[model samples]
Target chain A: MRAVEPEIVVVDYGAGNLRSVAKALERLGASPRVTSDPRALLRARGVVLPGVGSSGTAMAALEERRLVEPLRELMARGTPFFGVCLGMQLLFQTSEEDPRPCLGILPGRVRRLPGGLKVPHMGWNQVALLRPHPVFQDVPSGSEFYFVHSYYGEPADASLALGTTDYGVTFCSAVARGNLVATQFHPEKSGPTGLRLYENFLRLLVLEEARPLPWR
Target chain B: MLAKRIIPCLDVDAGRVVKGVRFLDHRDAGDPVELAAFYDREGADEVVFYDISASAQGRGIMRDVVARTAEQLFIPLAVGGGLRTVQDMRLMLKAGADKVSINTAAVQNPDLIGQGAAAFGRQCIVLGMDTLRVPGSSPPRWEVRTHTGRGGGRPTGLDAVEWAVRAVELGAGEIVVNSMDADGTQQGYDLDLLRAVSRAVSVPVVASGGAGDLEHLYQAIALGEADAVLAASIFHFRLYSIAQAKEYLAQRGVPVRRVPVPSGDR
Candidate 1:
């Protein structure tokens, strides 16, 4: 018997720079639909909240499309969720880039990358994995991932931290709780190691098919 | 700490990758998609493709090129040249390009920079500034050159370093400072120009043009203080590869992205 292919929905909230993410998923045999419609969000086997802009604008885009509640509902229902960059930031309560309220699915404030350490933190940086999650299976402990963000999530609950990378201040790179996972780096642009992470994420979906994810 | 990036720039004209010398003397290098995959396997931090030919007919081919390159590699791909409108940017970004660089077009409409940053966010809007020293200026300052010199060159009085800061203020997340004076010269980078721009900008500055040897690349980082260095001819002509450049940078103490060292060579 063959396993059903995961139908991943890449949330499109008008915060462009998502095609790369969708393309990466397509390469791994997952047909990801880039959509803002709430109905699609409900049906997705996996949901990717990929973002690349200020939190205020990003939240406004989500609000305009009325996806704020449906996304929360998707998580409440235990859909395997993934968020990238601003997408990861929006999963938290609030952000320094703006006063807009986030999904609050996770607890934290997305603060600026301190006062100094290079504004965008652009380039490949090594991530030190703190936890042994399935997403990181077969991936090395100190593998490098491409990063391009000015702010990182500071989750109120320290246990959510899975990977941390240092600039001037060491910050959280990947966080997880149950089957849901999010990352501050752009895995799609991170070369083969990045592709491995996605491959690992897809494996999580495969695992979900056998065992429905438990609620956090 | 974030490692310094060594980016290989693939300047493409028509459908094939071409090398640009001083933004002129376009010569065939290889297929854009093939070269990009090679660079990715060799451990390039990122790959930038400038669609030098923005012909009305060549536009479709360029999009296909960007799409094809993105299909093969996971590294960041930035395409510039011939993008005059936000729709042009939209087309490329939708074609799997992570960033859309604006050069002559940005100079023509400065507001376009802010527009791109507003629409796509600052990170996607890269300001590609081509600079050259004012021919008869008393203080010998670098001016932003508007034309590719393929057309008659138009040098703006705007100082390159100051313009970089203004462009960032307007929403350019990163700046690529290409020295017109040293672009094809390959003697070395315009360290003086690079150091000046690197000091002034709060955002990351990509020191482009004039890379002949590994030492030149090292200086672009260590002395020039550029956040990243862009190379064309040397890599195109086989004088150096991105792997060798990274190895040399490692030996010189400048932190860079590491690739698995191939066996049997030092």
Candidate 2:
């Protein structure tokens, strides 16, 4: 008997290193479909919204593909969703980089990181866990993760913050609200600790699949 | 606090790592992929593959090396050397380079910086600056050189500090300050140049081309104000392992990431 890998949909908004995210997922034994297709996302066991573009461009790309509503609905419907960097930023309603409105999935706004340090905050930084989430399973406290961002998520509800990191001041680096998990750092590019995060998220999807749904 | 990154640079020429680093794990240091995996296990914060492949024939091999290394590395992989077009940037990013450093081409065409930043966020578009102290300039000006800091072409006459500030304005997310005169000296970094550029630009500045000891690394961060220090000979020769460097930095209050050491070595 052959084991089955979950079909994780890597959203391609025409921005972001989708190939890198997909390759990372593949390395973890999951079949990831890189697509802008709403239908693929609708049936996806997990959705990874990865980005490396300005918020305006990423939103415009999603709007161009008519995926704005579908994406919001998918995340709202409790799919194992993951957002990274600008992907995490776009989950909020607005950004300092651009005036364009985002998905507004999470009740927050993306603000520029503290300028007292490097604007990009590019390099390895450690995150201190405020609360345990499934995503950080097997990850050590203060394990370094690679980061490259000018902005970070400022969730309106501070309770949603799962982890906090410091650039100049302490800010939310990872957030968890139900099954939707997002990180200010690129876990995919963060080495073994990063791969462990992906593996943990995959296990969450597998667990969700194994759960006995009330409807079923 | 953000931990200072210790990045070991691999110079790839004709599809092989040319630095000749003999690792206890990997048999061939020339194999970029194997060496990358070894570094990954060694607790390296990131790995930079400086592709020195100048020929068209070597481009295919370069991409293959990047793909295989990317497959194994979970850390940020930065690629540079002869990336002239947006397509070249896209190909490497798709092949798994977390960032693309454009040096010579960026100098020839300044718009490439903005175009890259617009197409693929500024985070991945690194402006690699090779510098040289001009012979007869007031205020001790440093000029930008391309083609791996060869130092004999159509001189732009753009001051290094001004070039860095302008590059940031042009959407460059990061700046790598490589001193051509100090490239192989291993004396120490050009602190005056680094402090000037770091003060001029808000983006992270990576100090490259000169590093002989652990003190050089700490000084690059503490005195030079560099966000990261890029070294080749020091790391390749095992003069200091990433773990040891981080421990030393941590002891000196430099805030370096502690790369976990192998049990047997302990």
Candidate 3:
């Protein structure tokens, strides 16, 4: 039986957490296509960028596949874009890792979190919503999400920050501006509450198509 | 929030499921594929198939069983026992095992842990340690044992709990602390061992051995602070269905996935 659901694309840039994110989207009744294919990504109602591991390596893969420019173009069109973990970090201007250049999609520098916070904060942490976004519509203010990362992004414009979490210090945990949304936590591993976020994203896709685009 | 996981451990020997008293009953339980399918339907969060037999013939049989079970089950599956080399881990992973566990091999060569983690991400590697409390020891020290609980060697000169902490630092994504004192006892989980290990490590801990009933599973979560509870004999014998176990745990306030009951089988 063919399933009728909104099509979503998860950017598989030879990184980590692609399968888990795809499965979580599936559970939310969205047909998620895990691909590095820029054409499919642009065609989707929304796109999820997921990554784990070094930022330098991730950027290289995206560059090699010629996805860096395409992704930027998609965001220019204001298609809803969500970045996760390293996926969230790559949207910034640069990273501390080798070669140091990033997509520069968001005006920010990705730096390693200072010592004493424990590298790769590998556990559940509570996130406080700063700006209201469609993704956090149903999600509570202090909802906990699963996070595993060594570095964090610091957006030049604090207005882009959608949520903040405290580890060694309060830092940006999620960001959203216009059709862009990104989270440092792996929503796929965050259990039921995380699943609800993905479901809300799917709902936003439906809503976006039903209503006229303000930019259009 | 981190998702709570429910895992079922299957003790396989010579390509078949085996259960007994203190790992010696030697009775044929059922086909590994059939049992895995049943567990998947019962909403088992994941399945672990431990190849207890280290013999060459037994190893061959285990590969076949892992392949069959992988084909039948969908959720994450982990395979352990006699996984000595990176190739061994890679083979199991290719056979559909989501994670590969190492015990004696890891102890023999601690570098294997880091090597495996580098080859495959830490999330796909697990360090399974067999532990037992030392007799007449002050402050209660737990020691590591090997060879299917037959001998203790090298001691790793490390405390059981401390070793677990080091294992995660050495790039183990998860730790499985199986208590020698609790294996097949069915009395209850050794909560003290579980608590110590769970506290010592930041990553998820799977409590194995000594889970006898529904209450035992609940205690493992509430008291031991374990992420998952693994049992062999109880599930093998049909003493408690996975559905019933999950329902009971969920009712007791332990976070568990609700599995639908099979039609005409309840």
What C-alpha lDDT, on a 0 to 100 scale, does residue A72 get in candidate 3? 93
Q: Model 1 off-target regions past 4 Å? A: A212-216, B20-29, B135-140, B260-266
Candidate 3: pairs in clash: none
Q: Pairs clashing in candidate 1?
A: none
Candidate 1 structure quality by residue, lDDT tens digits, B15-60: 8776632221243336888778777878889999888775777877
Which regions of candidate 2 fall more than 4 Å away from where they truly are?
Answer: A1-4, A212-216, B136-139, B148-155, B260-266
1 against 2, candidate with superior TM-score: 2
Q: Once model 2 is optimally superposed onto the true structure by TM-score, how far is the C-alpha of residue A175 displaced, in angstroms?
A: 1.0
Better of 1 and 2 by DockQ: 2
Error of 1 at A83 (Å): 0.9
Chain B TM-score, one value per candidate, order as shown: 0.91, 0.94, 0.90
Give the DockQ (2 decimals) of all models.
0.56, 0.63, 0.10
Top DockQ model: 2
**How would you encode candidate 3's per-residue C-alpha lDDT over A141-208 as one tens digit per residue?**
87767676768999999999999988777889999888889999877765556766777787778877
Q: What range of 10 consecutive residues in model 2 chain A has the weakest lDDT sum? A: A207-216
Model 1 scores a TM of 0.93
List the candidates' TM-scores in order.
Answer: 0.93, 0.93, 0.70
In model 3, the Cα lDDT at residue B124 comes to 74
Candidate 1 lDDT score at position A79: 85
Candidate 1 residue B65 C-alpha distance from true site, Å: 1.1
* Candidate 2 positional error at B178, Å: 1.1
Q: After superposition, how far is residue A74 of candidate 1 from its true place, in Å?
A: 2.5
